[model samples]
Target: MTRTDGRLQVALVALCAAVFLDSMDLSLMGVALPAIGRDLSLPESTLQWLMSGYAVAYGGFLLLGGRIADLFGRRRVFLLSLAGATGYTAGLIASGLLTEISWRLVFFLPVPIALLVLAAAPLVLPRGVRPPGAREGFDAVGAVAVTGGVLLLVFALTEKSWPAGVVAVLLLGAFVVIERRRSAPLVPLEVFRSGTVGAANLAALAWACATIGWQFVAVLYLQQVLDYTPLTTGLGIVPMGLAIVITANLAGRLISRYGLGRVAAAGMLIQGAGILLFLRAGATGDYLTVLLPALVVHGIGNGLSFPSLNIAAVAGLPDERQGLASGLVTSAVQIGAGIGVAVLASMMTLGGSTLAGYRIAFLMAGGFSLIGALAAAFGLRPRRPAPVPAPTV
Candidate 1:
């Protein structure tokens, strides 16, 4: 391969690996939460906060992070995040193996990794030729408003606080006003004018809500209802992860052939079907009969839909705005996951029986997936841009 090809390949691998590690870090807590709670002697409420707090922090600053990436450089921000995530993962693994570790270790483990990434980033990533005027200052007020607004919203959902939600709405409204007045907004409002970007973000939000909510239910069913060990529970979900990895690559090619909107809609429909299948699960149902098939189907849908939505979101964006586009997509995923966990988990407890609650939660999640499918089909319908004419001499 040529030098340019080699650099591109490296960049692709690094970025993909970063995303993979980030996802794993986020998800590792699901199956392990009970174990962590027991070891730390924590209440269920505290455990809940630990899980939701990560999503809040991640989602809240994502737009700001993107703006920072655009201002400083994408490579720098990515390397920093990746390194911190890696260290955090390592610390978690260590805590698992060792006995009687302090719970605070879990929260502070990423600090060392952040420092290491700070030192090593220049050597690991390629130095690109900076775009002209790339170092423009960011909109600090707009950034603060949006970040605070998203955090409050996420916190309200997680904690079920109506007053916080109202405050969040006000803050977000202020963000819009500030962005309009700013010389250079953190996120250029014009990007939302593109149907593709808007639809992709909406679809991503719905997909995350459904899938994360389903997974939360599945974990509870496996451990609490079925009485499986945590290790066994983790092992049982391996096939779903493998299916996602395999199908995601295949979906990229399918997008090249069928277009983004069609593939995304199909994926969502398939995922909804998977969740609908879970309605058959009962207190006495076996994993093989009730859960495995749903897991496989859901995995396939995730693999197909997520990549297509991502491609669609960034399809028409200029190079300089790519970081912002990516951040928006990532933010949607985090926020949706937070909302899903809060809403669906509550549904699971409000019904007559555990089995009944599970069924209701599954139905709601499935409905969200179907809604996403409809949105993808109609809202993201592709409109190829007209070509600019050749310039006259």
Candidate 2:
């Protein structure tokens, strides 16, 4: 391959490394939560903040991130973001192994990785490509409103703070008004005009809500209820990860043949079924009989659904708006994930972390997937071809 092609590939790796940091942290933190809680003497509600805080920050800034990339430069923003992604990729297993050492070490593990990524980013990522709207003013008001609004909303739901909830609502409402008035809005209000974009974003939100919350609970179930060690808890989830990797290879082909809507719908239905299967999990639940099958089923569904949702979210949009579409969908996923974890955490505490509470959380997660399925199946339907005029006419 040419030097240019090689550099481009390396740049892709750097970009993907940052993204892996985003998704992997969710699971890694889940594995560490029980240990973190035990060490800190924290409750379920508080333990969840570790996960939700990162998710909310990631979600809230995504739109602003895209806008920054456009205004500054993609490579510059990527390098800046890569600094944050820097951490040990070994967090999955390391979170377990390190938590044994000290739960604090788990948080420290990523520092070296970030430094390495930072050192390499300047070398790998290309420079000099500026977006058309580089001169446009930043939407500072919209950014603050959305970010603060989501933060407060998640805080309210998790902590049961009514006053915070009220402020969150007001801030979010103001965000809509602010965006509408801006000449170059953080997110253009017109993107939602397309049926596919709207539905696909909704589906993406629900999918993240169900899966992230379920993942959080699954780790707790294994470590807390089933009495597995942090290391064993980390290892136990391997089957699902394998299933996702295997199924994701096939998901691309399925989307190409069946289209985004059908594939997403089918995937979500399978995911819902998988979560519902956990309804049978008990205090004395058997790993082989109960958790293993559900994990694999859920993983396969997750693999299929994840990629399609992003594609559907951007479908039918003009080339210029593709970045905005991507940002919007990712924001939906992250925000939904934060809210889902908060909701499930509340459910678990309601039953005092008993098997009944776990069951309720799983049921609610399943319901989220079902909502995703409906959005994908109906909302993402392909538009009909416009009729051609007769030759005579």
Candidate 3:
């Protein structure tokens, strides 16, 4: 209708497009892992790092990224990030097409995306009201501490190195202390005081943990156990992706009616039910009977829960703290993903048999989803309608 509205719409489109590309990249990698491992001669232990490493870095820096967006301008950061991501995606495409390549390429795939978002500082984005004095509050020490801590923690989990884990704990402790002391902390400790924000983040973390873990196992099961080719595996999962997309569009309207907590809780429960369906699947299971149903259900749950969680996270935050809220929620997602993959993968390998391990992992995932559903139910509050102003005489 208006120029501002048009610009906002364009900006939203761009953001949505960027997110879609990022999601596509993740899904593609999941399907391609078996092929990459075979081609690069990577072991299962090392293969797990491909996802975990990205999760760690992405999660660890999310707060910092949000802080940067607050200080430097969200538009600038977003554009820069998109550009960097585009470049990395191109590199990944090239690597994927090559006959001979190293597993290291897979690890490096998300790096460019990260850098692109960072470098997008110069690009023009929709103009909006800026938070006053946002630049003055940056916490350098806290950033380093948190980032290093998360990275080391994830590395330790993946590599089974206790020493690194200890170091990670210490660094994270230092981060807490640093944040407590800072006048303008990267993440205001006060935000966690809100039940809604805290619960939403926790639910987000749990959701990611379950879904990502399930995805890791599912991909392997399809390729290794079912003996499907990479292309076939990817194609097979397309329905799930489509389901997620379709349901996500519908979720917003549902939330508008049912509220975030109800929608999110219901979504989580549905998702958990879908994962539970996998318990019946075995080595001899077929795609239609064993995987498709679970996939569709899981997709529906994802579509509903993700948007609801996001809305709940920032529902009542001041504009000034919006960036921090976003960062915190995203960090939860990344951390959950990293932890889930590490824990579930370990369970799979440690189990007596591959099929047994897969079952265990799926069960654990379902358990986490149910737990998240409970959290969403108890923690989140419904949005209140805005008051209407009286008409002037």
**Regarding lDDT, does 1 or 2 come out ahead?**
2
**What is the TM-score (0 to 1) of candidate 2?**
0.92
Error of 3 at 104 (Å): 10
lDDT digits (tens) for residues 192-221 of candidate 3: 888899999999999988998788888898
Clashing pairs in 2: 86-114, 87-110, 87-114, 88-110
Q: How does each model score on TM-score?
A: 0.86, 0.92, 0.87
Instruction: Name the lDDT value of residue 181 in candidate 2.
Output: 90
lDDT on C-alpha atoms for all candidate structures: 0.77, 0.85, 0.81
Q: What lDDT does model 2 reach?
A: 0.85
For each of the candidates, give the backbone clash count.
0, 4, 7
Off by over 4 Å in 3: 1-5, 87-124, 382-393
The best candidate in terms of lDDT:
2
- Candidate number achieving the greatest TM-score relative to the actual structure: 2
Residue pairs of candidate 3 with colliding backbone atoms: 80-116, 80-117, 80-120, 81-116, 81-117, 84-116, 85-113
